[model samples]
Target: MKVKLYMATKSAKQQASIIGLLFAIVCFMSCQRSSNNLGVTENMEKDKTDVAEKIVLTDEEWKRRLTPEQYRILRQKGTERAFTNEMKHLGKGSFVCAGCESELFVSDTKYDSGCGWPSFYDTVDKNNITQELDSSFSMKRIEVLCSRCGGHLGHIFNDGPQPTGLRYCINGGAIKFQKDDEDNK
Candidate 1:
């Protein structure tokens, strides 16, 4: 009976070790996967102009420049309620950074992602934006920021349409649309 009890204990220890090994393997494999899709390197240097011309403002200055909602999303990294942006249907303009008036996205890239916020497949210029690994709220995501002002625009995801399977899920409050002349006509 003692022998059987000892064998049972040994088997339990082996099971625990196997479970631990499996957990470690999963974590290691996940870490191997690249979190960024746009090829923004983990240590990529910002452009000289982007660095030199960056918009730096104090909280009071930002408050003065942006609307309350814009201040929340751009400066505070807060999110607007999904589908709440009035500019979603503007259809023909470039979206500029609310904080710095830097063009961040064009209307041509806009699409209905049904994620409740404005979604774009591409940016007006790659140099206008930057990305960072976001691990907030117990989830891992790629956070998109305005390179000119370092403001939080949104998060990018791998699921998107052809040409570039990346979704720049931006907050509308962080941007202002300027209608093109053709759109005005």
Candidate 2:
């Protein structure tokens, strides 16, 4: 009877150790994520841009304005496959919303985040974009949108370089790049 009791205690101890190890791992990952969030704006306050400038279009009008791929990503919240977009190599330009042509990001803020999509550390104007808490796909994320047209540009992650620590993982199809005049020459 004593031998049986000893074995049961040993098994319980092993189970406790495993649980402890798992908890430690989860804590470590959470810390990593949170640390990267430094410099990111916690409160997504609306910028005092002119609401009158907002472009409200019918579904059919949007369909006509944007390409099919752009329509999918911007209007339907779809993601493009990584590293396949031409925007990755673009230089000296401004990225505008595909739906409303609103200036969103500048080429100076663009960086290669190795995330496949175009990553920007900042926007040309903070008032041009909006963010929402997206709890889709069993994960929590900040979804970035074009404030004027309400188009889904992409998701913004805290895991980015300094200054803002924001990686705007935008779908290439969701934006149109206008080359700077100097760049064109």
Candidate 3:
């Protein structure tokens, strides 16, 4: 997914300052990817800024935009019931971050696990996720974070549905889907 950074400015200094702030925010939010096949991290070059960034939503703003169930599950670390998430049958599109609407996963990476969740073989980037130890349902699991806004997206499992052997069990409320246009492809 693309990182969107909103910049409102009245002058060059203000624009530079905003850009700097955005840089710092992105740098802090971004995680470093290890060559050892670990997971994403929060480290990168000091000045590799690109132009794909769009405006990011504030916490309060997102809360207002999303339903209580969505906010609770995606932003507040809550979980939805199994076999109930709406993204299960989702196909042929890009899944953007619900909090910011950045394209996170393409349809090609999607796979079915019959585990009542949307699974992916890989992410748009290795540093696209943050790892956490989740012990909520009296069981331990690895929690996935959006890395950009530190939003809880879902979990990762080793026993995935297919060839990649990695299941990225994402929360339905955590993302927004943009179906790919065949003509565009």
Q: Which candidate is the best by lDDT?
A: 2
Instruction: Tell me the lDDT of model 1 at 25.
Output: 58
**How does candidate 2 fare on TM-score?**
0.76
lDDT of each: 0.79, 0.81, 0.65
Candidate 2 residue-wise lDDT, 106-169, digit = tens: 9989998766778898988888998877767555667789999899998787877888877887
**Which model is ahead, 2 or 3, in terms of TM-score?**
2
lDDT by residue (1-185, candidate 1, tens digit) is 99999999999999999998996555433422344444533444543454678989899999998889889999889887666787667868899998898999998899987677788989888889887778775556778899899888988776777677777888888988999998788
Looking at model 3, which ten-residue stretch has the lowest summed lDDT? 28-37
Candidate 3 lDDT over 1-185, as tens digits, reads 12223233346668789998986554322211111233322332222223344345777897898788878977788766555667755557788778767566877888766655677877776555667766664555667777666678887766554566667778778888887687356
TM-score of each prediction: 0.74, 0.76, 0.63
List the lowest-lDDT window of 10 residues for candidate 2. 27-36
Cα lDDT, model 3, residue 3: 27
How much is 19 displaced in model 3, in angstroms? 56
Which residue window of length 10 is worst by lDDT in model 1?
27-36
Off by over 4 Å in 1: 1-49
The pairs that clash in candidate 2 are: none
RMSD of each: 10.7, 9.7, 19.1
Of the candidates numbered 1 and 2, which has the greater TM-score value? 2
